[model samples]
Target: MYRLLAVDDDPAVCRALFDYFSSRGFFVATALSAGEALRLSQTPPPFDCAVVDVLLPDQSGLKLCQAIKETGAAVVFLSALGSEDDRVQGFLSGGDDYLCKPYSLAELEQRVLARIRARQGTRAQQVLRFGPVCIRLDRRQVEVEGRPLELTCSEFDILVFLAQHRDAPYTQDAIYRAIWNQPGLDGTHTVQVHVAQLRKKLAAALPEHSLIQTVWGKGYRFSPPPTA
Candidate 1:
């Protein structure tokens, strides 16, 4: 099951999302404050994503997203303060998506599923197969020769982004802009760290082959499957 964290100061909103997502087969954890959300991040593995309200009891959702990013969790900001700046800040803080207030439950489910699918490193009906590794997007899991491979949040995101456009190269600037939302100079290292970490994990899990390849002076791309 995909586990999610729903952070909001309003008890009603928290309960509503919990009940809504639970019925749709998601295991939802509710936090009434940014402090509580921070506490939940310390929990062991299996936490897949988060939905945070911009206005919390003591802190902004953007701030909470920063904290969650350290734990490598995919985040979405659902806020009443639905301004362009608010959404941008959410992304800058490492949120995968931004949602405005009074959102439909259906839309929420779709976004949640998209995030989960992306994390599993799959998209649509086509299972991503690179070398000996396979990923099931709908199931949100990665497997190497039938065994599940553990991946951090960032690692999974990087892998999925690459897998989605196999054989297509993406520059460091483009990848950083897509994955890490921060701008200017300092953000450069963020993508590099994530890519390095992801590469190491993939190497450790499948050493015989490298799925993600460097493009000399360019950037990186997912190598296409070997021709039969």
Candidate 2:
């Protein structure tokens, strides 16, 4: 009996998700706006999963996904924009998965269920360090100069992946396949946005080090500093 949250401005989509996922044994709840969804999560038992639409009346679902990702709920982005960059933005925003609009209901259910199961997977023990930044995988905490930094789940995961494979260059497609665990990921730039977000946080945390660098046509690589 997993609790689910569905957010969309369209009444028809809202009803459809509610009715369909409910039949699938999810205790589904609905919200028409980002603010409404945030408010709903403020009070009670948090949702296990969220199905969010990118185009919403109040705010972009990307921002909403970042807001609630730390709650440990799986998020799947639903959007009409099907471009590579658009899908990348959805993934970069900390969503566990992305489904373009005009998608089949069956496919959506499969994605949503997969995301939920992925979130429920076991936690790994890993600690990565670069300068003053420290990432504790067991607790999923990121700290810089002994201070904590707020990062979305996707951002944290991307940084961990790069750090674990220091000096290794991975094309966007390769990184996307590894992180999303999907074969032959279609969206080209889907991995770039997440890397960019991680770099931004690293910049703020460790100004002296570039941390991740572009490899021209090769892709991106993690640059770790000399160990003391």
Candidate 3:
């Protein structure tokens, strides 16, 4: 099982993440502050991945992230502050990914899984191919029927998530959680809007309508190509 170290001051957040990821077949250890994280990172075997809050009680998460990077662990920043500058700082601090606050556990799981897959080298097939659409994991590139799809960062992320789990029915709320990473925004209509955009762009590129299908009260699923 993969091991993850999570650093956050909020006990509730830490507990939620620890339980959520653990239930998903991960060995997760929680740290309530930067000091605890730093101390844990120095131990033998270390941790395979880390989820860090941008703020900590003892020190800044950026600093903690930097320290964790030195340990050669994959770093993901989870912050309440979602500024471009903040994200840039996360990357500069050696973090591989950045997630804003109020994030959904599903989205967090997706990002964490991606990082874990990357670290596993040959075991991680980061690319997903459906019909003519191909998504390259490392380069973060997407192409449909040989034509590149110009998608915003979040759009691409959502598509990648759906494509990877094609045909699996998921709710709009669940999709929002996976894509936007905003948990409390459950009843919000943001997910529908993004899905519409995703479908429009993908449909224009691909020769298919069932690429993304709504399952009525359930959510969306990536439909397979019809047999010729």
Clashing pairs in 1: none
Per-residue lDDT tens digits of candidate 2, residues 114-159? 7876776534335667777788876889998899988887677667
TM-score of each: 0.55, 0.53, 0.53
Q: Candidate 2: misplaced stretches above 4 Å?
A: 122-228
Residue 221 accuracy (lDDT) in model 1: 90
Comparing 1 with 3 on lDDT, the higher-scoring candidate is: 3
> In order, what lDDT does every prediction score?
0.77, 0.78, 0.78
Decoy 2 TM-score against native: 0.53
lDDT of candidate model 2 versus the reference: 0.78
Candidate 3: tens digits of C-alpha lDDT, residues 1-228:
456889999999999997898787565778998988998787543467899998899999988888888877889899988888888988888889999988889998989878867775634466666667678876788887788888877677667667656746777776665555444677447777887888888888875555888888767888866544
